[model samples]
Target chain A: MSEKYCIGADVGGTTIKLAVISTEGEIVKKWEIPTDTSERGKHITRDINITIDNTLEELNLHKSSILGIGAGAPGFVDSSTGYINEAINIGWKHFDFGVELKQLTGLNVWVDNDANLAALGENWLGAGRGVKNLIAVTLGTGVGGGIIANGEILNGANGTAGEIGHVTVKTTGGAPCNCGRSGCLETETSATAIVRKAKEAIVKEPHSALSSIKEITAKDVFVTAKQGDIAAQQILSDVTETLGLALANLTVAVNPNKIVLGGGVSQAGDQLLQPLKDAYSKHCLPRAAEACVFELAELGNDAGVIGGASLVKQYSNEQ
Target chain B: MSEKYCIGADVGGTTIKLAVISTEGEIVKKWEIPTDTSERGKHITRDINITIDNTLEELNLHKSSILGIGAGAPGFVDSSTGYINEAINIGWKHFDFGVELKQLTGLNVWVDNDANLAALGENWLGAGRGVKNLIAVTLGTGVGGGIIANGEILNGANGTAGEIGHVTVKTTGGAPCNCGRSGCLETETSATAIVRKAKEAIVKEPHSALSSIKEITAKDVFVTAKQGDIAAQQILSDVTETLGLALANLTVAVNPNKIVLGGGVSQAGDQLLQPLKDAYSKHCLPRAAEACVFELAELGNDAGVIGGASLVKQYSNEQ
Candidate 1:
C-alpha cells in the first residue's frame, strides 16, 4: 500500500490555510489562499478545490494516495455534513462546503468549527499529546473553547457543546455581551475585554503608565504590569481571577487531563497562567485540581489545519 | 444457548438493592439487603456474594446463566476497576469491591458512582431513552450529577466528569459548601438548601402559612407554594432561578439533548419544572434552549440498579 496523505483547510475571513499532512502526523506542505467573500462565499469551496488539484499535480501525488479533506469554518457547522448554517465572518449561510469539496476532489470530507479543530490539533500534537481528555480555550478577539472528552470532540445536542465563552461568570450586574447575555466569560476575559478593562482601570488611575498611551492592548497590559504599574496589575488580577473561577467550574464538569490555553492573551504566558492556576486551585475540587494540568498551546497558527487533517484521519478510521 | 441474565446492585449507606435483569433490559426480580457498615464495610461485598449465591440456588439458576454483576456505590469510584477510593457514607476508604464480588461469584464485575448509575439508567430506559447526550441531576440531601455524551458515560481524567453540583453560582459571599467552596449550585438548590431558604423566608414573613409548621421540609415548601403562600413561592423562585442559571450554563458546555431532574426534590414536578424552564429559556443560548428539553426522571429509586444492569450490558458489548 502506498503512503496516504490528507488535506486540512482552515477557512477564515482573511485567508484560508491549507496543509498536506501524512498519516504519520507530519505536515508535508502548507500554504494560504485569500478567502473570497463575494456572493456569500460561493467561490470559497471552489477555490479550495482548485488549489488542492494544483497542489497535488505539482507534488506528483495521485488522488488515490490522498485520504480526504478536513475543513474548519467559523459558524454553527454540522460536523457530519460540513454544512455551514451560518458563518458571519465569511458570509456563508446554509452552504454545503464539505460535500462540494468532496465531490470536486473525489475524496471523503469532514468539517468542524474552527475552535473545535484547534482543540483537536492541540490535543493530537501539542500540550495534550498522549492524553485522551482535554479542554482548549482560545482567548482571541472573543473567548472560544473546545472540549475533548473520552478522545472525541463534544459537539453537544445542537453542535454548540464547547460554547465556553457563553458560560455566565457573573450572576448579576454584569456587562452586556454580544450573545445578548450578561457577564459571560468572554465579557471579562477575551483580549478585547482585557483592553476594555484597561480603559476602565485608567479612568481610576489617571496618572498610571497605561493612561499615557492613546491605545492599549492586552500585550501592553502585560508589559506595563511587569514594569510595576498598579492599574495594569489590577486588570490582570481581575481577568485571571474571573477566568480562573470559570475554568475551575468548567474543570469540575468535564474533568479534562489538561487545559490548553491559546490565542492572543495567552501570549502573556506565565504572567497569565500563575494567577489563574492559583485561583483554579482555590476554587476547583481538590481531586480534579490535583489530576489536571494546564499548559500553553504549541501549534499556534497551524492548529486549525492540523486539527482538520486529524478529523479526516479519525473519520476514515471510523469508516 | 439459554437466555442469560445480569445482576445489578445499588449499594447505599443503609441498604443494597439488587435486581436480576435480562439482556433485553427487563427486570426479572428485585430485592434488597441491609448494608453492613461495621468494620469499614469489609463484609458488605461478602454478604452480597452470599445473598447472590442463595438467590441463584433458590431460583435453581446456574452460575453459567449469569453474564456478570454491575454495582453502583457512593463516592469516588474508579469506574474501569471498580475501586472505591473513598465512599464516606459506606466507610470504604480504599477497597476493590468489584474484584471481590467477581472473585466470590466467578463473574465479571463493573462498578461506577451511584449518581452516574442513575444517569445511565435514565438514559438507557427512562427520560433520556433514544438520546445519545443527556444530563441527569439528583436533588436529594445533596446535589449529584452524571453526564452521558455520545452514548458513553464520560469518566474524565480521574473519574469526576459530571460533578455538576459544584459548579460555582454565587461566585462570592455565598453560603459555604461541603466541598470547601462557597456559592456552589449545591449550596443553593439541594433539598437541604430549599428547606434552609424556606426557614429564612418564614422569619421575614411571620404571618405567612409556612410559619405555622415546625420542622419544614422541601415537600412542605412545594405544597405551600401551590397553596398561594407568598413566602414559599419566594423560596421556590430563588432556588429555581439559581438552579436554572446553573443548568443553563452547564447545558452550554455539554449540550445534552435532555436534562433529567431526579432525586427527592424533583418530586415537586410541575411546580419545579415550570419555573426552571422559564429561567433556563431566559438564560440559555436560544439555539440550545430550543434543542434541549427537561424531563422528570422515570426510574426513581430503581434508577441505580437498572443503570448497573446497563453498565454490565455495555461492558459486555465492549468485550
Candidate 2:
C-alpha cells in the first residue's frame, strides 16, 4: 500500500505554488504554475485544476493515495462555508472556490485566508513550532497577520480574527488605505508603504543617492540605508518605528508567545528586526513586551503551501 | 450532599461587592462592604476578610461547603499566579492578593481584572449567555474591555489579551492618556473623555445649559443632552461616534458575536446604542459589521461578583 499524501495549493495574484506532503508534514513533491488573475476569477480555478493534474501524474500518485486538497488565497474567506467573500486584488466577489474545486477534481477541499495558512504553517513546522500562542506577520505589498492561540487559529466569528493590517496604528488618520479606511497600520509599515514613503523622500531630497535610482523598492531603501544613505536610512527607520508601534499595540491585545516576521521586506533581516524590537519595547506595556519574542519566519515563501497541506490534514482528522 | 457554591468578591477603590452563586450560575446570596483603598494595601485584605466572614455567617453556610473565591480588581493581574502587579488606583505594586486571601479564609482564591470579570459574568449568565465569542465594553471613568472566545476568557501570553481600551482608535494622536500614550482609544471614548469633551463644548458655547454647571459628569451631560441642549448633545454624539469607530476596528480584529456595553455611562441605553451601531456599520467592513450584535449589559452591578464567582468555578474545573 502506498503512503497517503495531501496536496496544498497557495493561490496568489501572479502565481500558484502547490506541494504534496505526507501525513507527517514531509514534502514529497512540489511545483508552480502561472496564475491568470487578469481575467478576474475564471482563470484562477482553471489554472489550479491543470496544475494539480500535472503534479499528480509526475509524482505517479494514484487518486486513492491522495487524501485531499487545501488552498490558501488572499481575501476574506468564509472557511466554514468554503466561500471567498471578496478578493479585491483578484476581483473575486463571493466566489465559491471550494465547491468549484471539489467539482473539478473530485477531491475534498479546505480553504482559508493565505496569511492564516502561513501562520499555521509556521506554528506546525516553522519558527512557531513548540509555541502554542503566536502571531505571524507578513510585511509584503500589504501588512498581513495570522494568530494562533491555544494551538488553534484565532478565527473570529466571521473568520477575520487576524486582520492586523487594518488595525489603527496612527491616532490621527494618515494616508488612505485600499480597504477604504484611513490610518490603517498597513499605510505606514507595509512594503508598499515603505516604498511610497521612500519615493516621497527622494522627491523632496533630490541630492540623495536614493534619488539616483531608477525605481526604489523596500529592498533598495534598506540596502542604501545600510551603506549610510541618510535619506534611505531615515525611510527605513520610520518604517520600522511604525511597525514597532503597531506590534506593541498588538502585543497588548493578543499577548502572543512569539511574533514571526515574514514576507519580502523581512528579508532585510537584522536591518529591520533590531529597530522593530526597540520600537516594540518602547511602546508595549512592560510585561507583555518582555514576554513576547520576535523572530524571522523560518518557512519563508513555502509557508503557504505547507500550511495548506496541514489544513487539509487537520480537517480530515477532525472529520 | 448539599450543592456547592462559589464565592465572588469585587474589590473596588471605594466599595466591595460579594456574591455566592451555585454551579448553575444562579446568585444564591449577596452583600456589599466598604473598601478602604485609600489606606494603602493592608486595608484591602482586612476588608475582604471581614466581608467574607460576615457573608458566610449571614447565609448560614459553613466554610467547607464554599468551593472557592474569585476576586476582580482594577490592575494588571497575573491570573495564573493570582498576583496584582501595580494597580495605580490602589497604590499597590506586586500585591499577592490571592495568596493572602487564601491564607486568611482557608479557601482557594482567583484574581483577575475587574473588566474581564464583568465580561465573564455576562458570558455565563447575562446578555452574552449563548454567545461563545463576544467583547464586553465598560464605559466608565476609563474604557475597559474583556474578550470571551470559545467559552473561555482570552488571557493572552502575559495575561493582557483583552485590553481594548488601549487599542488605537485615532490614527492621529487625540489627547494624552494616563497610560503614557497619546491618542489611545480610552483617551477619546472613555466616560472621563466624554465629560472632558462636554466641558470643552460648554466653553465654546457659553449660552448652553451645560455651561451653567460648574462640574460635569458623563451622566449629567447625557441628561442635559436628552433635554435638547446643543453643546451637551454634540459632545455626546462625538463620544458615541468615537466608540462606534473603535468597535468597528475591534470587530474587524475580534469578529465577536456580540459587543455588550456596561459601566456607568452605558445606562444612557438607546441614546448611546443607536448612534454607536450606526457609526460602527458605517466604518466596519460590511461582513463583520453585519455579523456583530450590540446590546446593553444585562448583569448590571452584580456582574463583578457574578463574574468573579464564575471565574473560580471555571478555573477550578479546568484544573
Candidate 3:
C-alpha cells in the first residue's frame, strides 16, 4: 500500500514470465508460469488473471493496490487496440487480447510485439537505459527488432514499425526468409541462419570441428570459431558481415544513437561484436558511423517482463 | 497587431526562398534571393538577416511582428543546436545559422534538413495534412527522406533519422551510391541513377528512342517506356522495382501511414506511380501494406519555404 506497482507479462510459446514492478522500474516480485496455449490461446487471458489474483493473495495485497497491466506477446500486435495477430498452429488470429485481459483483471492493459517490449525494456532499464533513441535487435530463432525514437515507439501505421529482420540484406540470389522475402537480414544473421550457414559450409570442410557435431547450433559455430575453426569462423564472419551491413543500413534509416544487440546470438559477445563493428563502419555513412554506438542488450531474460512493466508504468504516467 | 506571422527560409545551392506565413498556415507573401556560396556560405546568414529586415521594413512591420524564423538547409543538422554539418560544395559545416539569425533578427529560430522541412511542409499544408505520421521522399538528383511520426519529426541522433534513399536494395553487385555504399536505394531510384541506368542499357539497344537522344534523361525514360520502347520500359521497370522494394523496406522498418513522393523524378506521374505501387504491394508485408498508403507530395516547388514556416509555427504553438 506504501508504493504503486504495475504488472507485466512476457508471453512465449513455452512460458509466461510475469512481474510486479515498482513505479521506478525495479522489479518488486517476479515469477513464471507455463503458457496454457490451448484453444488457440483463449485460456491465456484467464490464466493470467488467475495468476495475478493468486500472486496478490500470496502477497496479502488487494486488486486496488495495482496500477495496470502490460504484456509482450510473440505476434504482430496492434498496441493501440491490443489485438494480437496470427496463431498459425492454433488457427487463431486477432485475439483482441488486451480487451480480454482488461475484462478479466479489471485493470488498464497494453500489449505489443514481444520484441518491441524488449526494446522498450532495454531503453528504460537495460543496455540502452539512458539513450532516448535506440534500436534493440534480438538475434533469436528469427531476427527481431524494436526501434525507439525520441522516447516513443516508432509503431508506424501498423504495429510492425521495427521489423528490421525483414529488411533486405541481399537483393539477389539470397536465401528465402520466413517473412516471404529473400535475402532479409533475418535469413543471413539469425541463430537459425548461423546454424544453417555452418551446416552448408561443413559440406566443403568435412574435417572442420563443426562437421563433427551431429547437431550444429549457433553456439557451436561461435564456440568453434573462437577456438580457431576456420570453417566455423567463415560462417560467423558471413553472418556478422550480413548483420553489420543491415545495421549500417538501419543506422542510416533511423540513425539511432545506440544499437543494443540481444537474444541468443548476441551471447557470443566479442566474437560477434568486433566483426560487426568493423562491417558497420565500412558500410555506414561517415557522420552516422561516428555518432552511433553499438552494444549488447543487458537486461537478459528480464527484458521482456520489465519492458512489459515499463510499458504499463509509462502508460499510467501518461494517463 | 491582431494577427501573427512567422518567417521561413529555404536555402539551396542556387537560390534561397523566403516566405511570410500567417499563423493559420497560409502564405501571406513569398520571394526568392540568390545564394552567396562565397566564404563557404558563411555570408549566407547575414544575407538572410539583411533580407528578413528589408522584407519586414518593406511590409511596414517590425521584427517583433513575426513570431520567429525557421530555416531549411541541406545536409545533416542537429536541430536542437541548429548545427548544420558538411559543405563540400560550399565549405559550410557546423554553422550555428539559427543562433546567428536569431541574434541578428532578435527572434526565435529553428533550422533542420531541407528535405525534412519539405516533408513538414507537405505534411502541414500539402498532401499529408491531417495525417500525423508519414514519410516524405524527394526524388531529386539524389533521393532524400524525412520521417514524421505522431506529428513530430523523427530527427534521430545527429539528425539523420530517415535516410531512405541510401537503404540497400541490392545486397551484391548493384550500382554505387554517393554515400559510399553499393546497391543503395539511391543508386537504383534517384534521377541520377535513372539516367545512369538508361545510358548503360542503351549500349544493347542502339535503335531505341533513348539512343536517338544524345542526353538521355529520367523523363525520356518514362516517356519512351510509355511508348513501348523495350529499353526504356526495362529501365523504368528496374527503377520502380528498386524504389518499391526500398519503400517496402522502409514501411516494414517505420510503418509510416503515408509515403509522399516528391522531387523531379516523381514528376513522371502515374507512369512511375502505378508500377511503383504494384512493386510496393509485392514487397511489403500484407498487414503493413493494408494500413499504409502512397501519395504524391503536393505543394510542389514551395514545400521547402512553407516547411520552414511550418516548423516555426509548430514550435511557436508548442511554446
Q: Give the best candidate by DockQ.
A: 1
What ordering of candidates by TM-score runs from best to worst? 1, 3, 2
Judged by DockQ cut-offs, the docking class of candidate 2 is acceptable
Q: Write the per-residue lDDT of candidate 1 for residues A1-319, one digit (tens) a residue.
A: 5899988999999999999999899888999999999999899888999999999999888989988988999878888678888898999998888888888878899999999999999977788775788999999999988899999999988788888898887767778888887888998999888899899888888988999877788899999999999989998998998999888888878988899999989988999999999988888888888879999999998999999998888889888
**lDDT score, residue A275, model 3?**
95
lDDT of 2 by residue, B1-319 (tens): 5888999998887778899998888788888888776757677877788778888888888988888999988878888888888787776688888899999989989989998999999988999886877999998889888887666787787678888788654545578877676677788888889888877887789898888887788888889999999888888778777778777766766678899999888998998899889877766766677778998899998999999999988887876
lDDT of 3 by residue, B37-58 (tens): 9878988888988988898888
- Which residue pairs of candidate 3 clash? A171-B171
DockQ of each: 0.76, 0.44, 0.65
For A128-227, candidate 2 gives per-residue lDDT tens digits of 8867779899999998988876667777887787888887655465778887767777888888888888889888998888887877788888988888
TM-score of each: 0.98, 0.86, 0.95
DockQ of 2: 0.44
**Model 2 chain B poorest ten-residue lDDT run:** B165-174
TM-score of chain A in every predicted structure: 0.97, 0.94, 0.96
Q: lDDT at B190 for candidate 2?
A: 82
Query: Candidate 1, which CAPRI tier?
Result: medium
True contacts kept of each: 0.71, 0.52, 0.69
Q: Rate the local accuracy (lDDT) of all candidates.
A: 0.89, 0.84, 0.85
Poorly placed runs, candidate 1 (over 4 Å): none
Backbone collisions counted per model: 0, 8, 1
Q: Every model's Cα RMSD, please? A: 1.4, 3.8, 2.1
